[model samples]
Target: MAAAVVLAGLALRFQVPGAYRSPQPWRPEHVMGLVYPAVGAVVLRRRPRLVVAWLVWAIGLLAALQVVLQPLSRWAVAEGATGAAYLRWAAFWIYLLEFLPLITLLPLLYPGGRPPSRRWRPLLWLVCALIAVNVVFAALLPMRYTVGPLRVDNPVGVALVGELAAWRRPMEWLTVAAALGCLASLAVRFRSGGPVERRQIGWLGYVLVAVLLLGCLDMVVATPFALWIVPISLAVAGVPVAIAVAILRYRLYDIDLIVNRTLVYGALAAFTGALYFGLIGAVNLAVSGYGALAGLAGALVVGLTFQPLRLRLQRAVDRLFKVERDPYRLADRLSRTVQQARDPAAALTSALASTRQALGVGGAAVEIGDRDGGVRVHGDGDTADLPQEIPLRWHGATVGRLLLPPGRHDARLAGLLARHLADVAHAVRLTADLQASRERILSTREEERRRLRRDLHDGLGPTLAALALSLDAARLRLSTDPASVSESLASLRERMIATIGDIRELVYGLRPPALDNLGLEGALRALADDLPEPRVDVVVEDADVAGELPAAAEVAAYRIVQEALSNARRHADARQITVRLRRETHGLTLVVADDGVGLPMTADGRVPRAGVGLGSMRERAAELGGSCTIGPRPGGGTEVVARLPLSSARGAPAT
Candidate 1:
C-alpha cells in the first residue's frame, strides 16, 4: 500500500496534466513515503497492543499519504475534482502532523512504544502547546502554492505566507522550544533506560544526528556546484531506514567508525570546494580575459592538493572523533596535536603526553612488572630517575605504577594520570581482581534469577493450573448443576485475585512499586509517612530535580533514604529526622539527618564505622561515581550525606 502511494506520487508528478505544473517542490527529502510506514508496521507487530505503536504507524501512514498530496492536488484542480481547494490547503497544514508527533510523543515513546512516566507528561504538554500555537497561527493564513492554475486563497482573508507579524517571532520561538523539549525527552529516556534500550536509542539517534553532523560543514561553507544536496538527500532517506533497523535491530553494530569516516569525507568535500573557489578567485584577480585558463589552473591545483588534504583531514577527524579507538596510532597524537615546541614525537615522546600536558609535569612514565621497554624521551632532562612509583589504575582498576617526579602533586590530577597509564599494563592485569568482581556480580545475579524462577514455578504456576481445572469443572456442571456453577465461579474468582496478588509481589520484588507508581519525590514522602514516631520530613529542594534523575540513581537514592530513616528510627532512638535532596550542576546531594545521640565513631574518632547498611549505601554511591559519607552532624545527631554525580548516574563517565 505504501509503495503504491509513493509510486503514484512519482507517476503523477510526471504524467498528471496540470495547467500550472511549474515544478514539484517535493524532493527526495520526502522519500520517507514507502520506508516510514513499513518500519512503523514492523514496530506495531512487535508491540501489538501499544497505543503509541498505533500512533507511530498512523503518523507514518499520514506522512506517506502526504507524498502524493501536491501532485494529487494539482491533478485534482486540473480535472475539476471536488475538494481540490481543501487538498491544496492540506499541503500547507499537513506539516502539523509531520512535525507534532515526531517532536512531542515519538522520542518519549519509541522502541517499546509506550507513554513515558507521568513526570514526562508536562514536557509533552509543553510541546503540544507549541504545536497548538503553530496550528492556530498557520491555519489562519492562506496556502496558495498550487502546482495548477487555480488560486487557493486563505479562507480567513490572509496572505499565503501566514503573516501575523506580531505572532511570528513567538511562533518561531515555540518551534525552537518544541525541538528542545523533544531532545530533552530523548536525553531523559536514554539516561534512564537499560543498556539494550540505550543501544536502540543510539541506533536511531546517531543516524538522525548524522544529518546535522555531516551537514554542519556545508551549512557553514558551501560545497562545489551545490554538492551538499546529494548527501542531505541520502541522510534524510536514511532516517526512516535507521528507524526500521533500530526497531528490528537488524545488522546492529557500533556506529562510531561509520560516523567518523562519513563526517570526515563530507567535511573534506566542502573544504576542497572552498579551496577550488578561492584559487579561482585568486587567478581571476591576478589575470584578466583568460577565464578558461584560470578555471583550468584552479581545477589542477585542487586536484593536486585534494588527496593530501584529505589524508591530513582524515587523521584530524580521526583525532576529533576516535580517541584510543585504534591501537596503531600513537596515543599522544590520537589525543591532541603537538604544540610548536619541536617534533610531536620529541615534544610528546610517550603515550602519557596528554596527561603530561594537563599536569604541567617535567616527565612521566609507566613501569609495569619490571618489563624493560624502549622509552621515548622528550628533552635532555635526566629527571626520570628522580620520580617515585605510585599504584597505577585505569577507572579504579590497578594495573602497574605511575612514575612522577617528587613534587606536591594534586590528588585528583595524579589519580587521573595514573588511570591513563593502565592501557600499557592491560594485558597482564586482565585476569586480576576484575575477573573476581565480574564472577561475584554474575553469581549474585544468577542466584536472584533462580529465586524468582522457583517462586513462579512453586506458587503462581499451581494457582493458574487450579484455576483452569475449576473453569473446566464449572463448564461441565453448567447445564447439570446451575446452582453449583455459581458457587464454583465465585470460588474461582477469589483464587484468581490471590494469583494477581502473588504476581504483584513478584513485580514488586523486581522493582519498588512505590517508585513505579508515585515517582521519586512521592516515593520519598511515602517512606517518610511509613515512619510515624520519628516525625520524618522529606524536603526536595528543586522541583525538577527528581524528574531528571536516571532510574538507577532514583532507586539508589530511595533505598539510601529508606535505610537512613530505618536506622534513625530503630538504632538512633531519634524523635525527628529530615531527608533533603539538592541538585548541583554535576550531580545531586542527598542528606538524611536525625536529631539523636550521634553515631559511634571508629578508632580514629572522626569517621563512622560502615556496617552492612552503611556499606550498601556507599557501594550504591560508588557505582554511580558518587560518595556516601556518614559522620556526626555539626550541631548534634548523625548525618548520612551522599553525592551522586549526574554524569555517572546517567551511565556516562565524567570526562
Candidate 2:
C-alpha cells in the first residue's frame, strides 16, 4: 500500500511531454492533461466520500471534453486540412479551464482529517453541471465576432472567439467570488482545526489564490504576442508543484523559499549580463569599435569591484523582498548576558527573554535539574504549553531543551531561535556543572581536615602520653636502685601495651585495614567487636555484598555503620546493637538498630539535631548517590537504614 502511494505521487511529478500517442487528432504540448486526473482518481479511490462532490465535477468536465470539443474538432478537420482547423479546434479549448477545479479538489480528497459534510456536495455538483452544459450549448451555436462582413471568411472562428471574449468579464468576477467563498470556508474551518489541519488548509489557500490569479491573467492579459503568457505557464506548473510538496513532503513554504532564492539569483545573473553587454556596447560606440584590449581591461575592473557590487546588490534585494535580518547579534548578546548573570535564575531569565525577543514569539522558557532530582522550568513564572522542545546538547548528552509553544507564527525564525537557545542552555549547564564540582572539592577538603584533627586528638595524643609515662617510670627506677630494675621493667611493659592499643586505634580511625584485607563483611564484623556497652551482634547474610563492593563504597558503608553505632552509644544510649548487611537483587542494604533510650525531640515531636555525626553519615550516603534515613525504632531505640543504588555499580569496579 505504501509503495503504491509513493509511485502514484512520483508519477504526478514525473511529466514527459509528448510521451503518449493520443488517439485524438491532435495533442497538447504538455502531458499534464493525462496525469492530473489519474492522480485525482487515486485520491478518489482512497477517499470516495470526501471527494464525491469533486468526482462529480470531474466527471462533468470529462463529459464536456467528449461532448463539446471532440465534435468541434471533428467538424473543423472535416472542413479542410489547413491552419484554420487548428484555430477552430483551439477556440473550443476547455483543457486549461478544467485545472482550476482539479487543483481545488486535489487537497480536499487528501485532507488532514475526515471529509467535509454532504451539505456542500450537491451545491458543488450543481456548479459543475451548469458549467458543463453551458460550454456544450455555447459550442453548438457560436455567436458573431466583428460587426459586419469583417467576420466574413472564418465565421465559426470569429464567432467562437468573440462570444468567449464577451463572457470573459462576468466569468472572471464569478471566479473571484467563488475563490473568496472557498477561502472563507477554509478560514472558518481552520480556526476549529488541529495544528496539522490549520497548516495544510493555509497552504491550500495560497495555491487556490495562485490558481485564481493564473486564470485571470490567461483570460485578461495574455495577448497572442505578449510576454504575459510566460507567467500563465509558470502558474499552471508551479501551483500543482506546490500542492504536491504540501501533500507528500508536508512542506508548504519550501516552494516559496525556492521561488525567492531563484528570484535572487535570477536578478543577479541579469545584472551581470546587462553589465557585460552595456560595457561592450559603450566601448564600441565610443571608439567606432574598440579593440579586444579595451574590453579585457573593462572586464578586469568589474572583476576587481565584484565584492562591493555584491554587497550593494544584497542590500537592494533585502529592501525589495523585506527579508528578515539574521539574529547572530542577538545570540551574542544572550551569551554575554548569561556569562554576566549572578545566579541560575537570572541566567535562565535572560536566555529565555532574549530568545523570545530574537524570534518574535509569545514567550520562551528554560528548565534545569533541581535538588530533588526533577526538572523545574524557569523564566516564564509558570509552565505554558510547549509547541516544540529542542534539546540542548554538549558532548552528546542532553542538558536541557529550548521550549516554545506550538503554532508560533514565524516557523523559520522559530527553528533558528531553537538552535540558538539550545547553545545558550549548553553554556549555562556547563557553568552550573563547574560551580557544583568546585563546591564538592572544597567540602571534601574541609571533611579531610576534620578527620585528621579527630585522629590526632583521640589517638596520637593518648599514645604519646602513655609512652612518656613508661619512659619516666623507667628512668626513676634506674636512679633509685639498680636491683629494683625487674619491678620497673614490669611497670614499663604495662604502659607499653597501653600505648600500642592507642596506636592501633589511631590506625583504624585513619582507614580500616579489615575493609581492604577482608572485605565489607569482615570489616563490619571487626567494627562490631569494638562496641562495649552495646554488645553488638553482627549478622552477615547471603555474602554477595562482601567482595562485590568497590573499595570506596565499602569504606563509605563501613563508616556509616560505625557512625550509627557510635551515635547509638552516646546519644541513643543503646544497650544492644544489631548490624545487618544483606544483598538484594538491585543493590546492597545496611541496617543498624539498637535498643536504647531512644532519641531527643522538639516541641513538635520530630527528632532533634544533637550531633554532627548523624549529619556526616547522611552526607556520606549522599556522596555515593544513595539515601539515608534515621528514625526511632518501633518499640525502643533508633534504626538507621541506608540504601545504595547499584545501577552504575552493578558489577562495576571500585573506581
Candidate 3:
C-alpha cells in the first residue's frame, strides 16, 4: 500500500505541466505521509502485534492518496478532460476518507491503538457512522466545487442540493464532536497508563500542542509566510517521530529527565530575557547615558540568579509531572535515616524500601549469607529470583548482596544504594560483635562468682566451724583440767592463724591487692617474687608507665602477667621466667616469656583442649578493646604477649 501511494504521488506530480509544477516550499502533511509509514514498517518488523503500527501505516497511505488524487483531478478539470467530472467526484470522496480517520480514529488508537475501555468501543462505531453520513451528503450535493483554478460538478447530483447542504452542518458538528471524543479518549489513556505508556503519549502530546500553539500564533499575528511555515511544519512532522520513539522506548528512562531539564532551562531563559529587558528599560529611565553599564548590570543579575531560579523551576516542574522517584533525593533520604536509626536491621529495611520505591521495581532485598548458613534477608517479598545483585562490602569483605527486580538497568543508582547498604552492614556487624563480647563478659563474671561461692562455702566455712568447736571445747576443759586447756588453746591459736592466711588468699584470687595499692608495675614485681621454682625477673621499661595507664589497662596488664606466670609454673615447667612491661604512645604492652616447654599443640595445629586459660587471657584483653597472643618464644619456650589500648580502657570500665 505504501509503495503504491508513493508511486502514484510521483506519477501525478510528473504529469502536471512544468509551469504548474515549479519547486514549492515543503508541506508538513505530505512529508509526514511519506515518512510515517516507513517508521511503521520498522516498528512492524519488530512488533507485529502492535495495532498502532498498522493504523499509522494506513494513515500515511491515506495522506499520500489525498495528496496525489486531489491535484490530478484539478489538472484534469483545468484541461477540460472528458472524465473530469467523475475524477473530481472521486477526489472529493477520497479527500473526505483521508481526513476522517485522522480526526475520528487516530487519537483514539494512538499509543497502543485501542479504545481506553470496552465502553469506548461504542464511541468508535458512532464516529464511523457520522463519517459515513458526511461522505454520503458530500457526494450527493449538486454543487460545483472549485478545485484550485478549475471548477468541477459533483457527478451524482441531487435535486435537493440545498437541503443536503443544510444537513451537512449537523454532520460537520458531529465530526467536530467525534474529534473531541478522540482527544478525550487520549486523555483517558494517559491518565490510566504506566510509566512507559505515559511517556509515549507525553511525547506526542508535546509535539501536537506545540503545533497547535504555532497555528494559533499564525492566525493572531501577521507572521511572515516563512516565519510560521517552517516551525509549524517541523512541529507537525515531529509528531510521528515522537510516537515512534515512545513506542520503541528508546531512551525511555531519560525522557523524564530530558523534559524536566528542558522545561526548567526554557523557562529560565525566557524569564532571564524578560528581566534583562525590564532592567534595561528601568536603568535607561533612571540614568540616560549608561546603556552599556545597564546591560552589564543586567548580565550580572542574571548570572547571579540563574542557579537559584533553575533549582526552583526544576522542583516546580517535578511536581507538575508528579515525579516522585528521584535517585538523588532517595539517596539523601536513606542517608539521613541510616544516621538516625538505632537498629541496623531497621535501617536496612528502610533503605531497601526506598530502593524499591525509587526504582519502581517489583521488589528489593539484602541477603547477608549463603544457603548453608541460612540467608538473612531484609526488605519486602522474596528476592531470590531478582535479576540484579550488588555486593555490599565492609572492611574489604563481602558482607551481603543487594537484589533488585529486572527492568531498565540503572548503574549509578545501584552503586549509590550499594554504598549506603555497605555502611549499614558495617554498623550491623560491629553491633553484633559488641553484643557477643558483652555476653562473653557476663558469662565470665558468672563463672568467677560460682568459683568464689564454692571456695567460701566448701573450704572457709568448714574450717571456721571446726575452729569454733575447738574454742568451745577449750573453754570447757580450762575449768576442769589446766594441762588440757593449755594444749587446746595452743592448737586453736594455730588454726586461727591458718584461717586468716586462707581468707587473704581468697581475696587475692578475686583481684590483685598489689594492683590496687601499688599499680601495674609493683603488682608484676610482687607476682615474680611469689613464683616458686626457677629464677624470675621483672623489667619495667618506663618509670611512668603504670602511672599513665588507665585503671582497666592497669588491671588487664596485671592479670595477663599473672596468668602467664601461673601457666608457665603448671604446664611449661620453665627453668626461668621474664615479665616485661613497656609503655608506648598509644597504650601499654606486657610480655611474659618462660624458658620452658612451649604450648601443647594437636595434629591440626590447634592448641589442646586444656588451653582454656589462654582463651581467658584473650577475653580479658578483648573486654578492654585490646589483644592477647600466646605462642612459642624464639628461644624454645612459651611467650604470652598482651597490648592494652589506654584510650579504649579509659572508655570501658575495669572488669
Candidate 4:
C-alpha cells in the first residue's frame, strides 16, 4: 500500500510527459504528498494496536499483489530462470496468506460482538496453524514457465500447484461468503448506533465489494486476455479510487453542491475547448487554398468562436457556484420539511427518513437532552439492537445524539447523517429559547401592571383621603371661632398642597403624562419645568419628532432625561442646566449639560461619577434599542446625551 501511494505521489510530482523516468522518482513533492494521509491517519493511531494490525494486513496484501506479479511479468519477458522465478513468486503468495486470518478477526477486535467464550483463542490459533500449513505446502511447490502441460516441469512439489488451483475454486466461494458476512456485520453495526465503527468498517466493505466486482469481471474477460493481468491491473485501480472516495469524503454530506459544480463546469470547459479547437483546425485546413488569407480567416473564426465559448463557460461556472436554496438539494428538502412540521415528532420523523435516504444509513433517530445530565430518545426509527443512547452535542455542550443502525452500504454514512442532525437540533433549541423568552416577557409585563395598580390603591389612596378630611374639618371650624379657624385653615392648606405634590409624583412615577401628551420635546420641557433648583435653560429646535414608537421606548426616553436631571441637581451643584431636544435623520436626540463641578475621575483609572441614576437611564435607553452616554463636558460641566429612535418617540403621548 505504501509503495503504491509512493508511486502515485511520484507520478503526480514528476508530471513527466513520458511514463517511466524523469526527476520524478526522487522529488520532494512525493514526500510531502505522503504527509497528509499519514497525519490524518493519526486518528487511528489512538488505538495503536488496531492500527498496527491493519497496517500489517495491508502490507501483506500489497506484497502479494505487487511483488509476485511485477517480478513474474519481468521474468516472463526475460525468459531466463523462468522456473525458479515462478517458484519464488509462488512462495511470496504463500507468505501473504498469513494475513487473511487478521481480516476475519478485525471486526471482532472492535468493541462490538458478544464477549467471546474461553475457547475463542484456541479456535483462532487453530485457524492460524492451518493457514501456516497451507503456506508451507505452497512454498515448496516447483514450476516451469514453458507451457507443455497444465502441470509444471519442475521437480519439488510442482504437482501441488494443480492441487492448490483446484482448491482455490471452492475457496473462491468461501471468500465470497466472507465478503457477504462483512457487509452484513457493518450494516448491523451501523444500525446499532456505532457510527465511528461503521465508518471504518464501511470503507473496508466498499473496497471488498469493488474487489469482488473486479474479480468477476476478470473471470469473464480472462478467457480472451490473461487472467493475472485483469486482477492485477483492475484490482490495483480499485484500491486508489476507493481510498480517494473515503479520504476526500466525496459526496458524503452537504459537499454535493461543490461536487455537482465541479462536474458540470469541468464538462462544459472540456466540451467548449474541444469544439473550439476542432473548428479552428477544420477551418485552417479548408482555407489553405487562400494561403495567407486563409490564416486571417481562421484567426477571425477562432476569435468569434472564443467569445461564445468563454461566455457560456463563465455563465455555467457562475450558476454552479452561486449560493442558492438548492445547494444540497436533499438536505434543503429535509430542512424545509422540518421547518414546516407541526410538532417535534413529525420533524424528527421527516428528518430521520430524509437523512437516511440522503446518506444511505441503515437507521436514524433524534436524541434530545434532558434538563438533568442525561439524554432521552426524542424521536427515531432505529432498529431494536442499536444502542439506546447517542452522544449529542451543540457547540462544546453535549445536547444529545442520534443513534443509527447498521447501514446497507458503508458505516461512514451514519456519521455523515448524525452531523447534519446535530445542526438541526441546535437550531430547534434556539427557536424554543426565543419562544420561552417572549412568554416570560408577557408574564412579567402583566405582573408589573398588577403591582403598579396595587401601589396606587394601597399607598396613595389613604393619604389623599386624610387630606380631604383635614380640609373638611377646617371648613366646619371657620364660622365657629375666628382664631381657632385661622390656625386650622393654615394647617389644612399646607397639608393639601403637600398631598397634591405627592399625588402628582406618584402619577408621574407610574408613567409620565408629559410623554403621553406631546412627544419627547414636550416631555423634556415638562421635566425641566418640574426641577426645583438650578435654573435650567431649555432649547427646542427642529423638534418635529413625530410618529408612533413602541410604548416601552417612550417611557425609556422620558425616564433617561428624568434620571439625568436628578443626577445633575444632586451632584453637579451647577448654577445652570441646559437641555436640548431635536430631531435627526434617524431618531430624536437629547443633550443635557450642567455647569457644575464635573464628575471626578477615580485614582484607579476609573470615572468616580456616581451612577446611581445613570445605570437605570442606560438600561432604559437600551430597552428602547437606543443608547445614552454621560461624560464631562468641554466647558467645566457634565453632559448627558441620548439618541432614541423616532419610531419609538411617536408612541409617547404628547406632553
Q: lDDT for every model?
A: 0.68, 0.58, 0.76, 0.56
Model 1: residue 199 alpha-carbon error in angstroms: 5.6
Candidate 1 clashing pairs, residues 3+ apart or interchain: 393-419
Best by lDDT: 3
Per-prediction TM-score to the true structure, in the order listed: 0.43, 0.40, 0.54, 0.42
Once fitted onto the true fold, the runs of candidate 2 whose alpha carbons sit more than 4 angstroms away are 1-29, 41-76, 79-93, 96-137, 143-235, 249-253, 277-330, 333-655
| Pairwise TM-score winner, candidates 2 and 3 | 3
Query: Candidate 1 lDDT, tens digit per residue, 304-373?
Result: 9889988888778767744333332333442444343344233333445554434434456655541112
Which candidate has the top score in TM-score? 3
Q: Any runs in candidate 3 off by more than 4 Å, and if so which?
A: 1-15, 18-24, 93-98, 157-162, 167-170, 276-308, 319-330, 335-391, 399-417, 423-655
Models ranked on lDDT: 3, 1, 2, 4
TM-score ranking of the models: 3, 1, 4, 2
Global CA lDDT computed for model 1: 0.68
Worst 10 residues of 1 by lDDT: 370-379
Query: On residues 476-547, what C-alpha lDDT tens digit does candidate 2 reach at each position?
Result: 878688677777677768877777786777677667888878788877877788666779988877756764
Which of candidates 1 and 2 is the stronger one according to TM-score?
1
Q: Write the per-residue lDDT of candidate 3 for residues 386-488, one digit (tens) a residue.
A: 7688999877878788887666757787788788888887666556656655787789989999999999999999999999898888888887887888878
Against the true structure, what is every candidate's RMSD? Answer: 29.6, 20.5, 12.9, 14.9
